[model samples]
Target: MNKVKVLVCGDVEGKFQTLFSRVENINKGHGVFDLLLCVGNFFGDTDEGLEPYRNGKLTVPIPTYILGPCSAVQVALYPHISGCELCPNLTYLGKRGLFTSSSGLKLAYVSGIEAESDTLSHHTFTDKDIESVKNACLRGQTNFRGVDILITSSWPKDIMLGDKGCSVQIEPNGSWLLSWLAAQVKPHYHFSGQEGVYFERAPYRNHSFSGSTPEHATRFIALAKVGNTLKHKWLYAFSLAPIDQMSTTHLYQETTDQTDCPYTGKMLHPSLSMKQVRPSQFFYDMDSLTDEGNQRKKARKDNKQQHKRQPPKFDQESCWFCLASATVEKHLVISVGSESYLALAKGGMVPDHVLILPVGHHQSLSTLPDAVEEEIEKYPLRTSALKKYFKKQHKVPVFFERNYKTSHLQIQTVPIPHNMAGRLKRVFQENAEQDGLQLDELPHHTKLSQVAPPRTPYFYVELPSGDKLYHRVANNFPLQFGREVLASEELLDMADRADWRDCKATKEKETELAKAFRCAFEPFDFTL
Candidate 1:
């Protein structure tokens, strides 16, 4: 089977003695693991806290990988050193890189946290550091098949969303970029520390880059700080096989009917089915309410009624793109400009596909103010800038816009590989003909408002080579014709991710995409 057992530990917090004892006990009881992966905060909480590790007072029992830039002093003293072997068995994993153990276990890591400023710190990792790692993966140096395990300093943001029995507020401490990277990398297992709570999420599947096939479910685990008496577990262990061993036969054959938590080995349904306690019942004693408390409650009720009587601030309550509405996922927003902003498209047709939209609620380009129209016209430049940033040397930008008359204005930018541009028009035409709808080629300067009457819904696809339009007076036309065409060109099944609402991503994924776009678009942002 060629399986490798791995022991994952949370923040050591300088509890070397306790950590050593725990590993020893685990080894004695459960047999030896191939590797020990420590997440972060390996040293104590203060400067000069790594003396024990540096002075050889503590020993790592197994081949241990510790996430690094150990301390400011160590980093400054050894700037050129990627990682140092603290002892025979202990080695730092460096700031951000990939490493493959002798057992053939490939691991990718992003060490440290996002700092508030540029000031260097032992535990600081920035978006650029993440981008470097991403670029390496894209370059195929890290093995595009995907890493066996991914380690990060903090828990991914919004990982708890849609998870039953979870009510904790996810703080912004975790990196959104890492979350997005996880989705792209599709690692089989992901480990994180620094959330102060031990959590293991249900495994979820992501599309593999190799083809349209879905990869095995990726398990995400967040460990609480070591030695935390309550709500914390010091370590976790799991068995993983080599990449080649992860074949369809083995995966399907080994699958069992049991629905147990992958980490805790408990029944998932039972845990998820636990009833939630009401806030009123859990926090208060109704019998103890005094007359003063009663009066306070009545006063609060009156205030709520008074506020409810006031009208809403914005009229576009139903518009998903409107920032004021709850439907707008703030994490998807890339860059905010004076008149318009950029955002990643949910269930995007291609990777890094983005949307440029005006700040105000406008049904169509014709209704946009002069200032907004001028800003919107600069989208072609922005699209070109994105192509350069992504290093799509042989790809050209394709812009698609829809003025469904009743829908808010948005300009979609997708990078189409040069080879696909020639056949893209034919592909769309054939697909439209299949749907019994005729496709019409339009001039680059042609606007939907001029072709169709006001409040008439229309879709347009614009490329540097030419432009195509589909005027729809009837509601039977496919609203997602552009996405469908692109998906078909890429040989992907559009039925899976055609609707954005059906394929909603976690906040972490959205944040990472937005951050990457924001950085790439920063140099080209005219508003800045």
Candidate 2:
């Protein structure tokens, strides 16, 4: 088998070890992964740390990509784009987007970069920069209005090195080159699940993982650092391999009797240890319930009444599925209307599928009643069945995918294999924990958005012509505890017509930000 080499590096306090163990489990499950490597940072920057993985104790060679900072494994994995050809942006990594964790709380550390050069200059990427990236990820966001790409271009402000300066120190005793290379060498393993302390499967198949438990903290990994030097700086990379890859192919599924566990059925009890458990409940209170429930109920009732009053006229704009039936054909390409969007289809096939949409906009399945939900679900199946009957008689997959905070209609391309679509769904569902699923439900009322009580209260005034002017509310008004809403129409109260008191301040702030972004993009015409 062609082996997959994963190199991981970052800050010491970050979850490198946990990532290693999880990758190991994935390798065991799929039996196609080889070598595990971890770069230094065991103690982070503290004076009291030791090398965790040392030379000669490793099972195989794996590379590590190093960086100055580290967040949790979920934030780390968020950078990866799947190798599947269906990836919409496989040709290029899109502009860096904000990455928030499942929680509404913005992490204080996450930063996102929008331009290519932004990843290169230390002046642009400071400790504060890293913090911004971490904050974005912690808030369960992947992209912001202006930010689309995420990466580390330069070291912290304390590091002194330049891209051109790196070439001069390539010879012997090149400490600068080694140090700089070391930062770039931190190769993170990007799996679909949470970090674990041990391995149970391979990268080619599903696997279970666990985090470091109190019982395993004392356990140490053997590691050795290799260095390269560039002029005036040190660039280095480290190598670490799992010491136990050969022992069991089944990982946590290993039974006391020493047999490989089946990948499916009763035998597959996720050997995930207790420490890796994540919360899996949805909590809501009366205020939110009242707001959401009433709106959804009203929409549904209106939809039903409209259908009864009309002669069953099909409106493609309201529902994507209806749109597909109205405007699409048997074997053509299809795309949804979500932001950060792309169209998808099978290789060498004509794009002939149309995505189905509801007669009215509904953000998620949870917002729909049982009947509407069922109708929505039928969109995929019906598309697949129709395509099979009229075209190749092949069962194509229907993906139910969407991004958070996007009003753009979610797109769905048809004529793709149902199995592949199913696989994608499984991949998402199975890896939900690792992907930090369900963490963004804090609702805007949370304390995370407490910006020193608004300096000016919002106001409203009526003009002689009966026109109303309103003061802008805070940009980020608390939605619920730990949750917030942007000063956007989605959360507006038209009747109140309150003046957006902070509009001028917010506009000035945005202007300043635009200047900064323009400055960052000055040398290069990124608009091209």
How well is each residue in 1-528 modelled by candidate 2, as lDDT tens digits? 122333332222433344455455555765533222232232233322112443223222232222222223222332322111111211111112222122221111112221233133311222222222222232222222112112232222212222222222222211221122122211121211011111112211221223331110001111222221222111112222221221233222322322221123321222111111111111111011112334556676888878432212224343222334443222222222221112221121122323344434443332444555555444333343333332343444333223222222333333333333333332222223322332222222332113213222222211111222222233321111111111111222111111111011233443444344334323322112
Report lDDT (CA) for all predictions.
0.62, 0.25
Candidate 2: Cα lDDT at 233: 14
Error of 2 at 123 (Å): 13
Write model 1 residue lDDT over 409-460, tens digit each, in one string. Answer: 7787777667677767776676666444677887767766567666566667
Off by over 4 Å in 2: 1-151, 156-354, 358-379, 382-395, 401-404, 408-426, 436-528
Screening candidate 1 with a backbone cut-off below 3 angstroms (N, C-alpha, C), the clashing residue pairs are: none
Candidate 2's TM-score: 0.27
- Best-fitting candidate, measured by TM-score? 1
Supply the global lDDT for candidate 2.
0.25
Q: How close is candidate 1 to the true structure, as a TM-score?
A: 0.45
